[model samples]
Target: MAKIEQVLESIGAMRQGRTGRFSRGVRRGLYGIFDLTAMTAVLALVVLIYIRFYGEWVIDHRADALQAASSAVIEDRTGTAVWRASLPEGGYREVASAAEIPLLVKQAFIGTEDRRYALHEGIDYTGIVRAAAVNVRSGGTAEGGSSITQQLARNVYLTLDQTWMRKLNEASIALALERHYVKDEILTMYLNEIYMGRGQYGIKAASRRYFGTAELNRLELWQIAILAGIPKAPSAYNPVDDPERAAGRAKVVLGLMAEQGVITAAEADAAAVRAAAYEAPQQSVVDAAGTAAYAAAALREAARKTGLPEEQLRGGGYRIETGLDAAAQAALTGVFAEDAYFPPDMGGQQTEAAMVVVDHRDGEVRALAGGRNGDGAGLNRAVDMKRQPGSAFKPIIAYGPALESGRFSPDSVLPDVLQTYGGYSPRNVGGVYRGSLTMTEALTRSINSPAVWLLNQTGISQAIEFAARLGIELGSEDEHLAIALGGLHEGVSPLQLAQAYSVIANGGTFRSAHFVRSVTDAQGQEIYRFDPEAESRPAMSAWTSAALAFMLRNAVAEGTGQAARIPNRIVGGKTGTVALAMKEVSQAANRDVWFAGFTPEWTAAVWMGFDRTDSGHYLTVPGSAAAGLFSAAMGKMLAGR
Candidate 1:
């Protein structure tokens, strides 16, 4: 009986302890509920205050929200964009609406980004929570919980710096965007506003840059996945620079889509195979000066004609439409690209060459080549290099001026013996001389003695006047008898050579040679126009032009310039060679050679010699080398016509 009473007492004590513990647990549960309720109320009040005040502030400034979103692109004659300028901050190309975006692309973004993007308003609370956990574990900003609208708000409305204040502003702006625009509009703005790698800003440009196509809908599933993964870390996943990382990111995007049932396992596998084989083309190495190399002369002309700085024109959102023929430029450049064109037998050591072609009818510069395989911008030899014209200068200095003098004609007799004038002696090549020859024979044979004798009779002043009329900028110190032998204080550029020859080709008319046809804004409103016809004026009489043309025609037909003869075509040309001597040097040094000519349709000039290299090394090659290149390039130019 005593043992049974002890057991009952122990059981009663245990029951009392359990009841007391249960009462304390109930109290602790109530306190926890109250704390959570208080926190929720505070969060609600803060959000309400933000929406009421900051949202109204954003709405008040809605007028300033939109920004310019187009890049200034340079177009070729055929309306093809060959180059694009840098985009301003908050700028992009044509926006693509969500509907225009491919469905596969959309699903890929949604799956890889916020899986519940459709359900979220502007911010995904679940993503934020998960990101917070991830960040806390990593001790860094390892994840961004931003939805598409949030990203758009951050890119357009707020600065890109990462900070709590910026985050708060981004959230506020994102909420406002969601209310102001529809879901599709928000997505469209986000897609276009984000920066893709390789200087591209929008989906349109990114599509064209990466895949070489602007039609995003035509992209394969793997391509769409690759693009979707790039926005997360553009530099790390840029397909052009880092293909393996891009492929890995793309695989992750595919896995996300498969998990979301957007694609099946077999489809994902097939897409993965395609993605493995995906490759972007290797970009060609462009000239260091970029498009400015090919278009430097054109840009200068634009500045001169518009009275604006070239820098201003480059940044003024203007589309420069040039009359530059791509094929002709290519053909001309290709002729000089071959090392064989400058053979060692021709004294082509360290030789550089330049050529310029103009459509004399309209003064449009058709082709301009500065150097072989050059960067195109530096020292544009065609327009910038000014060297002695050698015998090539005779047409402007001796023959044209003599014809314009009204005292000389193609048939006029001139003395070609060894002559000395004021201690200056002129002799023909190889020190040979023809006693007396007609002006036509003198020019066709490039007899130096007769050219000097004519200058003695006609005077240097008349040659200066003729060159000036032809728009060749002669130096003040160029008043000398040596001018008769293509000696000028500052020689002429290949561009000037081509332009001056145009007067002979086009019946003595002087038309300013230029490159740009017009410059317009993005809206196609013309800002500048080149009027070649209006600029045309007679530099010499028709009789002088006829006489000069007759002599020049004979040059190619039966003269030193025979190498430039294009079969089956009425071609005319002149050959020029000058022995250059530096200070303390004599005339037995390196020589500069030239060939300047014109047909009815074109006027071209070719210069070959060592300009920046050793001036002591003479070019053994004759002017014929330049003429051959000129002939070949001109042949291609005429073929395209």
Candidate 2:
């Protein structure tokens, strides 16, 4: 009986152990199921969020996804196209259609830029994974996995930033592009929009730039391979700049083409050989007309007025109407082209000159000559390069301000003796100073002493304020008596001088000098129009302008600017010259010479000097040389009037 009771208890204990194990198994299975369900929910939420962002950010803006690339036309005052501002990077963009692209060209680009381009749906997952692994191993971005579509999206809409957000945006936009356009259209746009080397954009421009031809069908297989390799790194693989590197890149492209079965290995090898032997044609220097300078200025003004980037303005297909007087441009260019019109070259260094003409009636820039030899596309000197105005500042800073202060008149007598102020002494030209002279005589003679004395008497702050009113901004460092002789920290440009002189020509009103008169979009909608009233402001009293004009007219007629006088026109002007460094002062070498003057209809300024005024390169002539250039240019500009 006792043994049976003990066996029953052992069986009961065994059953309880089995039941506890079963309950524990059931709880473990339930926890595993719950975790799986939670992971699935989290993944679904992530996918949903991605879809929401993709739809809102990309799909809704599909119609305007691709920014149209077109060349902007710059027109003169007569509504004639004077110049065409090329796409960003500086070359024309001739957008080719799908039909214009050759099959070989397309194959080369596909093989080199995007392997499996046709099989991908806007994004190449395999490429991305491979690139990720490579980047991880390299610990940097050694490879970019962007498809052709993704590149287009980045070039057009998104900035080329390495941030994840930019990458996501690029991916989304590329997907939208693929969805909106067919494969052929996408390819065509890509070909037409990619920036090639040498300031070239699009296949057509790049072809012309590299192969001296724009016809895509005429390109050799080797040339096509070279073109295919350039979009990877434009500057690095530019054939014109570095042919050996370009040939190596082209060989890589040929190998890719052969591997992808686009061409036979033998043909690829032959093309690579031809690429290795290819030599880039020597590019011709384009002798751009003076109108190109005007167009450049107009393009800049259009960008400023419309608040658009220069690249956008250049390629937005807008029509920019400028205040360019064709006749004036012709006259200025004609004068600048003639060696006889300029002073003789000194020490084997050719003298460079710049000029700017403005219509005082509306502050419209009529003409500009940036350099000699019709090199208008080089450094723009008229509006860009600044040099000392020398005594030119007398009228705007000293005499004009003095007269405007009502404490002095054109006839007011002032001391012309050599004087020192705050350890700075100034002397007249040739170091000759009369005892005393009227304000008119002092200005006519361009005596430095009286000019500085008048500035001191009128107060430097008051003179600077008056100069600012005329659009001649002075800096804090210009607060000294030497400012009376046009000595400033940074001197003024010819455009600034012309603009300042326009105050007297306009009878005391100041107007901002501008090149763009109006701008119209491709659809013929007027986007910007110049408003004279908005830019005009009172710079001085009419009496003061009249008095100064009278004094300046005498200066041109009988003073240092006698050569600047124009017949049958009431001409007024000032002559200025900056002496060379003290070592070369005995040679009477002028570092920079200027003549800023005005007629009733136009205000103009001429500047002549070397880019660098060392002992070897300095002007041997006086300010009268620039005055003569001013007379010659202004004479033809005012011929009809």
Best by TM-score: 1
Clashing residue pairs found in predicted model 2: none
lDDT of each: 0.78, 0.86
Worst 10 residues of 2 by lDDT: 281-290
Candidate 1 clashing pairs, residues 3+ apart or interchain: 69-92, 293-376, 346-621, 347-620, 590-618
User: What's the TM for model 1?
Assistant: 0.75
lDDT (Cα, tens digit) per residue for candidate 2, span 1-641: 99999999999999999999999999999998999999999987886577446734765666464655667877778886666666664566656768889999999898888887899978999998998999999999988799998998888777877897788777777877777778888889999889888777789878877887768999999999999999989999978888899999999999999998889999989998998888775642121356878777788889999998887878877888888987788888988989998878877878999999999989999999987855556788998999889998899999989999999998899998988888999877677878899999999988888998999999999999999999999999988888888888999999999999999888999998999989888667999999989999999999999999999999999999999988888899999999886674566878899999999899999999998778777888899999999998999889978
Q: What are the per-residue Cα lDDT tens digits for candidate 1 across 1-641?
A: 89999999999999999988898898888988998998899998987788556855775677355442655555556765555544444332544556669878778877886677788888899999999999999999998788887787777777888897688777777777777777766667677777777666767667777787668888888888888888999888878889888988888888888989999978888887777777885542121123445576776777787887776565455677776776777666667667777735233545788888888887888778887655564689899899989999998988888888899889999987887788989767788876888999999888899888888788788788889889886777988888888988889899999999988898888988888888886455888888866889999999998888888999999998998888678888898887755664555554688999988789999998776535445676678888887788798778836
The number of clashing residue pairs in each candidate reads 5, 0
Candidate 2: residue 241 Cα off by (Å): 25
